[model samples]
Target: MSDILLSAAATAACLPYPALADELAASLTDSAVTVPPRLVQPLPGGASLFVMPANDATVAMTKLITFTPANAGTGRPTIQGDVVVFDIATGTRRLVLDGPTVTAHRTAAVSLLAAQRLAPNTRGPLLVLGAGVQGRAHVEAFVAGLGVREVWICSRSPASAEALAAHVRTLGAQARVVDNAAAALPDCPLVVTATPASGVVLDARPREDAFIAAVGAFTPSMVELGPAMCRDLMACGTVVVDTRDAEHEAGDLLQAGVDITALPSLAEIVRESRPRPAGPVLFKSCGWGGWDLAAARLAMLRVCAEA
Candidate 1:
């Protein structure tokens, strides 16, 4: 069979947030799925290339992408690449999807899955830090999957933030661009941090029952939430990682010296049927191959349904 190449928009069309979340939820406990550790290699000028591979009984995929920190605010995507999917049984190439699109949407879908279980309250308005690709994807996910109606955006770049606000408005949600994310924290129970920061962006304390999805700062050297905030979450709230790998890649938690071993993972929550926490919930996502696999599987199912 001929391999199908899907553009970013096309790839996105296949992996709707609600459907993608269901796929992720199922894959989390799927014993047949195998996700190997992603490899990150340093590129010239401080950029890095990532290779993430995963497979299940029917489909296998590898996501190859480049992350350039310097590309922030440059009108160019910081993440760019493609995901190649193959038939597990025949080892035949089946599909090629836009990598960055898969990354953003799948990452947000994982957060949505976690929120379905962890968020104390799903009501809006949702506060999102950063105005890049992941920021846009999260806004779409929360609005679509959780029915969040209002979105408050905060970013270091005002222009980018407004652009994100415009995008939010297009999605039939009320959008507000705030200069201070910390100032907006108390009133906003649902929060997402998607920035590329070497230091803290959200430091202020939030409400007692807030739900925060921290997706930025994958490396130990990069941090978005303040160390103190991380500590407070650990002491008074519940911290959930997308995977056990966050113990190594989650900068905010690592910088604060939070013991990740004590925190539950998304997979565990799904498998054990864990309930929502009484206090605030912090979901730390460091990316996982299994998530990409979920996206690919969803897309393939869509492809077959359409055919």
Candidate 2:
């Protein structure tokens, strides 16, 4: 057994996101790999701690994440944690990787994959909700993966949203802070909502051909898309989840009284069983454990390759 560690920056430095996207696109199957629903523990002040574990044949990965929503108000990120990867056969710990970073990258990769299948031709004016870890990561992901022309940023904190927009401009992508995100939706074809708001952050869906990748609201009680959008998706089979486990964890769909089994999984879409449904396709993720394991292993390989 061998052990190694990498900072989030270092792991990100060597991450070939396009390649990782390809890897993840093929990683999920009916039985070969799976991510179980995370075990959750509520914390004081409405914060939450999650212990997630996932495994395949060769290795297993576990991540510990704590969400302190209040931290974002104080100039710190809301999510903090790390990921551990080990040999499954021997059960020996092999690598420890930054947790939130892994989550960010994997979450974005999943979104990108879903978008590739759902709205392969969409371009320009991507609307991103909440300028936090997931929001920032999704901006980079969309810019890299889709060549989006402009990104509209919206957040409860104007300064944080503006700060992210400024950083996004530095990446050669056009970005702006939108005071009214709902009003900005029609202009954008792809939207990524990465917030923990219990109420709807994005009031309306893009009316045209589009994709919405929602990552927040893991618990059954926290929702992001509100009632009408979920209801509309539920009726049309337009909603897609990163995995079947999302049925148990995705708050947006669960709260909207969605029929979990009715929605198709990402693997099913990727494998060609289901065509991308018509209009306002949604990819809701409650955070898949398989994604954590896959990302950690990729980081481990990148670490070794750079040595």
Question: Which 10-residue window in model 2 sums to the lowest lDDT?
Answer: 10-19
Please give each candidate's TM-score: 0.98, 0.91
- Which 10 successive residues of model 1 have the least lDDT summed? 1-10
Q: Write the per-residue lDDT of candidate 2 for residues 92-121, one digit (tens) a residue.
A: 887887788888888888888888778734
Q: Which stretches of candidate 1 lie over 4 Å from their true place?
A: 1-3
Encode model 1's per-residue lDDT on 113-183: one tens digit a residue.
88889999899789999898899999999999999999999988898899999999999999999998888
**Candidate 2 residue pairs in clash (backbone atoms < 3 Å):** 82-99
Q: What is candidate 2's TM-score against the reference?
A: 0.91
Displacement of residue 117 (Cα, Å) in model 1 is: 0.8
Clashes per prediction? 0, 1
| Reference-based lDDT, residue 141, model 1 | 98
Error of 1 at 230 (Å): 0.5
